[model samples]
Target: MAKNKLEISYEIDFELVAINASVKEYKLAWMLNKSLAWNLVKRENIELDFTGNKALLISNYLYETEYQTFRLIRNRAVDGEEQFNAFIIPELKNFDYFIMLENESVGFDLNAFISKIKEIPFVQFAVLMDAAALKSKDNLIF
Candidate 1:
C-alpha cells in the first residue's frame, strides 16, 4: 500500500509596505486616515500562537474600498512572552509596522502609495517589502 500526501499553498498577492515610525499604532492609523483621506478603523487584534504556548496579539486596523483592502498591523508582538522572537516578521524587526495592500484593480501605483505614507509627519520612512521573499511569510496569512 502507498500513502498519500497533501500540501497547501497560499498566494502572495498583496503589496507590503514596511513603515519605520516612533508613534503608537492608533496614532499612526489616525494620521494615515487623515493624511490619505482613508477611513481606517480599529479591528480585532490578530492572535498568533507560537510554540511553547506563547501567543502574540498584534493590533490591526483596516480600510476597504471597492477595489482594494488595506490592513495596518503592528510589527512588535503584543502581550507575548517571547522576547527574542517577538516580531510578526522577524526578518524585518527594525520596522515598526506594516501596511498590507490587497489591490484587486489595475492602475494602482505602489510607489506613489509609499510616498504618501512617507509624507506622514510621524513616519520616519516607508519602503516596499516583497512578501514572497520573506522567510516568515506564513505568519502574515491573516
Candidate 2:
C-alpha cells in the first residue's frame, strides 16, 4: 500500500512602514483592514502588526518642540477637549511607529498593495523587507 502526500506553498512578504506614534495602532489597523484597497488583494490572507520603537537613531533628529506639540494635540483629543482630527504629519519627524504585514497568498500583488499603504497619512516611509520570494511549507521526501 502507498500513501499520497500533499504540500501547500505560499509567497510570504513583509511590508514595513513608519507611522506617527500619535496615531493609535487600532485606528491604523482598522483603516488598513477595512479599506477597499487592502480588501482587493485578498483580505483574509494577510496579517498586520504594529509596533513602536523609541530607540531608533532617527528620533534624535526630531526637534523637542515638535514632539511636545504632538503630545499636546494627542492629549487634548484623548481627553475630549478638542474635536480636531489627528493628522499624521511625518514632517514632524516622528517615525517610531512600525507596521509589519505578512502576506500568505501566492497571487497577491505586493507592489500594488504597498503603494496603496503608502497613501495613508503619517506613513513616513514604506519599504518591502526582503523582497526575495519566501516559501513556507513542510518538506516531504519521497
Candidate 3:
C-alpha cells in the first residue's frame, strides 16, 4: 500500500531577544539560521529588529510529508497576528533591518523545532507569533 502524502504549508513567527541586547542583524540572523537549520524548519523568511534590548525574529517555515499530520495541525494554531501587524508589517514595508534567509529543512517536528530554537544560548526569549497549515490539491487524484 502507498502511504498518503500531504503538502503542509505553515509559518512560525517568533521574537528572539539576544543575550547581549546589542547584536547586529547579520549576527542575529546567523544565530537564528543555524538554530532553524538544526530543527529542520525551512527558513522561508526572517526579519530582525535590534532597536531595543529584545530583538524580534519572524520566520516562516514549510515542508512536505506523509508521516506527520497531527503535528502539523497543532502547529497551525499558534497565534501572533496582533504582534505581526504592530511590529512586523511596518518593518517589512520599510525594509530597514529585515533580512531574507535561505529556506532548507531535514525533518518534521513542529513543536520540537520551536523548543529547540528557544534553547539557543544567545536567545533570551522566543515566542510563537502565528502558525497555519494549508493542504495542496495539485497532486490529488480523483
Candidate 4:
C-alpha cells in the first residue's frame, strides 16, 4: 500500500538552531533549514511559518518536496516585529494549520497569537508546534 502523506506546518520563529538541532551549534539559521527539511520528509504538503526567517510571507506550490518544499514561507526575523500582525494574519487567511514550535518567543505575545490564530477562518490547528510530537515521535526532534 502507498504511504499516506499528511500536511504538516510549523511556526519556527527565532530558535532555528535550537529547534532544528539535536545538538545545537553556531549558524542557527542554516541549522534550522537543515533541521526543518530533515523533520518534514515524511509529509507531502508542508507549510512553514517562516515568520522566523525574514524571507517574506508568501505561499508557493513546491513540486519538489525533497530539495525544495514549502507552501507558506515567511520569516519573523529581518521582517520586523511591527509587521508581525500583518504577516501572521495573512498565513491564516487561507489555511488552517497547527503552529508548531518547541516554545514561544520571549517578546512575542504568544497568547495573543494563539487567540488570533484560532479565530482565523483558515486556521484549524494553533498549537505549541512540536511539543507533543517530541514526546511521542523521536528523541532527536525535541
Candidate 5:
C-alpha cells in the first residue's frame, strides 16, 4: 500500500497591537510554514520560524515514509505572492499530491487560484482545501 502526500497552507490575520506593530513578510510566512509541520511519529508540534526580514524559505522534510514525505514552505501575502520567491520543493522520487490553500478574510479569486497554481510545473496536484475541514479529517478515520 502506498501513502498519500498532502500539504495545506493557512494564514490568520490578527490585529497586531503594538507600539509599532511591526511584522516582516518573512516572519509571517515562516509562521504559516510552522503550521504545516504535522508529525504523527513524534506526536509533537514544532513551529520553526526563519531568521530574516526578507522573504526566505527553508524546505525541511520532518516527516518521511517509504511512500511519501510532506514538504511545505510558504510565504503569505494579501495575494498569493511575495517579493521574494517562496518555493515548495519536494526532495523525493515518488508520485505525490500537493494541496495549497489560501484563505484570506479579504481578496481571493477561485478561478485565478486554480489556473495559476495548476500551471506550476513542479505541482503534481494543487487546490484549496478548507483548513477547518482538513483538521477534522486529520483526527477522524473512516
Candidate 6:
C-alpha cells in the first residue's frame, strides 16, 4: 500500500519596509499620508497574547484601494508596568515602524516607494526588508 503525503506552505506575497524615525506613530502615519498622498487611517489596535499572560498592543494604520492594501504598524510596544520596550520583530528592533504593502497587481514599484518614504522630513530612513528571512515573520500576518 502506498500512502499520500501532504505538505503545507505559506507564501508571503507582500512587501515589507522597515522605517527608522524618532517621531510618534500617529505623526509618522500623518507624514506618510501627507507626503505620498496615501489615506492611511487609524485602525483598531492589534492585540497579541503570548505565554505567561504577556500581551502586546500594537498600533496600526491602514489604507486600502481596489488593487492594494497598505499597513503602517509601530514596531515597539511599551510595557506600562516594567517601562520596557517589546518589539514586533525582535531581530529588527532598531526599526521604529514597519510598512507592509499587499498588492494584487504587478505595477507597484517597491524601490520607488522606498525612495519616496525616505524623502519625508519625519522619516530618518526606510529600507526594504525580506519577510521570508525573518524568524518571526509570522507575527506580520495579523
Model 3, span 1-142: residue lDDT tens: 9999986543433222112213443455456557654222444343443445433344444332343211111111123542333234332232222222223234544456557646767645444322122132111100
lDDT of 6 at 31: 87
In model 3, state the lDDT of residue 102.
21
What TM-score, over all chains together, does every model reach? 0.89, 0.35, 0.31, 0.26, 0.27, 0.88
lDDT (10s digit) by residue, model 4, range 1-142: 8999987655333211111112211232233334444332222222334436533332212213333322222222123343343332332333222223334334656566455434434334444443333332221121
- Residue-wise lDDT of candidate 5 within 38-100, one digit each (tens)? 341221222323347543333222334444333332222122243344222222112132232
The TM-score leader among the candidates is: 1
> Would you list the C-alpha lDDT of every candidate in the order shown?
0.89, 0.34, 0.34, 0.31, 0.32, 0.87
N/CA/C clash count, model 3: 1
Clashes of 6: 0
Candidate 2 deviant stretches above 4 angstroms:
1-22, 36-103, 131-142
* lDDT of each residue in 1-142, candidate 2, tens digit only: 9998986554433333344444554455546555522321212211111134211111111102211211011111121232232212223234434444443346656587667767767555555534232121110000
Indicate the residue-level lDDT of 34 in model 4.
48
For model 6, the superposed segments whose C-alpha errors exceed 4 Å read 1-9, 78-84
Question: Which run of 10 residues does model 3 get worst, by summed lDDT?
Answer: 69-78
Error of 4 at 88 (Å): 24
Candidate No. with top lDDT: 1
TM-score ranking from best candidate downward: 1, 6, 2, 3, 5, 4
